[model samples]
Target: MTADPVVETLDALELVDHHCHGAVTADLDRPGFESLITEGAAWPGVSPFDSPVGLAVRRHCAPVLDLPRHAPADVYLARRAELGWAEVNRRFLTAAGTGVFCVDTGYAPDRVTTPSELAGAAGAAAYEVVRLESVAEAVAAGGVEADAYAEAFRTAAWEAVRRPGVVGVKSVAAYRTGFDLDPARPRAEEVTDAARRWLARGGRLDDPVLVRHLLWTAVDLGRPLQLHTGFGDSDIRMHRADPTHLTDWLHLTAGTVPVLLLHCWPYQRQAAYLAAVFERVYLDVGLTLHHVGPARAGAVLAEALEITPFRKLLHSSDAYGVAEFHHLGALAFRHGLAGLLRERLDADELALEDALRIARWTGRENALRVYGLPDGSPDDG
Candidate 1:
């Protein structure tokens, strides 16, 4: 008798990492950074296990602002070069088996224009570039420069979406950098105005807008919007990570823009709740797989699957830097998901098809639809 087509199918599918940060380094020393690249390229199961896709967010912009006051711009620029477009793609693609990479326009003035350059450098045949824009940053820099920035960002987004390998924009609204919403220090009007302006600038309908703006702009642009809904750095209060905060926004955007909740940190159950309740609310299991350890990751994925439709769930490595953290984080994510599926299904003697769906469909299919990419096997399609 033929064996059940479970593990084979699971292993056959490609992995679409919905969120990762490339072209950013945590280390200042050149040797240390190079070591990171070496380590990242050597992550296990990265090359042979499955097809790897990456959505590279620009990590240099805001994160740089948080660096120690003494750090010089030259140092920052040098670090960025070490984490340059060529090096990042080479390392990640070589190690992780990455086929498509969506590059973002980072926050820094110098690096803000890096996405397009990277796309050009990668030669569209190899990787996909997606430019990203931050609403809060534009608003904070309000003036002609803001307008110029908006125009530049809009141009990049449109170019990326239209380019051969480039994907659509990945709009980031809320972050620990205080770019999104902060109840204690709300920038609602600023955010709202900035979002409206961004939309008017011909931004794609699928990109996310932070906080209530996701709903506010849904009526005009009926597309998928990503939200940073889970665990983040220590600066962000865990309580604020609740997906419940976006409940009203989800309802408001009902039947309009789809919501892809990013992270969903310690509150995975709550993320599952939203996904279960709203067809438009999808979950991208990015940070949990990397930031959380094995045991916690297992529990969270189990809870999410139990409550939410597997179709609404997605995967992301959330890779940043060339360090061990980035490599291990991506590896742990895939491993954690595989392990969790094994633990859950082994008990019931269930087939691996469900796990495969979670791995492939949940991650890539939903993202493809949201980003408006052609739906086919990553290899053939």
Candidate 2:
């Protein structure tokens, strides 16, 4: 007997990971690797398998390394250690079923792959997403005076987007100061005063005016702007990261640029609501997918899909620290999305053709249209 047609089709989808970070190129011990899988910024000091994302690695990722299904934690880690980082990267990355990667290279600079290196390992086309903070820090370090901070940052940002591989820009305002900051653009005096304080002290760009100004600059450039929202590591203030806090800014920036919201978890529905009402806003449930694993991904993705327009949802792994996330993230998404869509098809809620079309749109077409990539071949699987 044949298997379910809906799931079979989803298995063949070649997704464009609209947002992600490069994998670590260095070798890892069990704890080092374990630290990567969990959502926290620091190592948990205990075994990672006690968590959802950890247990998921044991159940789903063990086999990709030639270990048996649900291999014991110690055994899986041992096998991973024996394989070394190179083989591990190639195996997991090749298994991810992704054709294009819009890579954000600003995370863990010393330990991670470059966008070029990432593309070579995954056998996919890779593009860059410049982090606003990285560019700002560079300008500050160049000894540009605070009075020139605004102009210097603007010039640096302008030059960054003009680079060969850059396709978009991202802000971690959710990580720094959250989305609760005043939505109005700060006046030039406010920017200069804030810049002076930040530079004279520790040279860190923590000023709210500067943050707001950076976001507004991205809007002016009119490229896709990625904002980290909702759940993250310990660094994020959970309550302050809610995307609903972005309502005022989204309203003001409407029609000026495309804003991509990343990693919406407890706020997935809220993000979906925003995407539904705002023409320029879109959302993704990445990092969350792999953490929830295939079994629980449906509930989360269903929440995101409930109000999100089909064209406004895109795919991402948000994978970092390890390539296993790159593999497992896509696996969990395929399993979850296929299962949910199949149930609807069977219950007569959706037509066969329409179901497949939505699957294609969320998996790739949406990202290509949003990020302006030329359409890739269908067999990218």
Local distance difference test scores for all models: 0.49, 0.87
| Candidate 1: 10-residue stretch with minimal lDDT | 48-57
Question: How much RMSD separates candidate 1 from the native structure?
Answer: 11.1
Q: Put down candidate 1 lDDT per residue, 343-364, tens digits, no spaces.
A: 7687975566666666667645
Candidate 2 per-residue C-alpha lDDT over 180-210 given as tens digits, one digit per residue, 9 for 90 to 100: 9899988999999988888888555667888
Off by over 4 Å in 1: 1-12, 25-89, 106-136, 139-215, 293-296, 323-329, 376-381
Error in Å for residue 26 of model 2: 1.5
Clashes of each: 5, 0
Model 1 clashes, total count: 5
Model 2 segments more than 4 A misplaced: 41-45, 376-381
Model 1 CA lDDT for position 40: 32
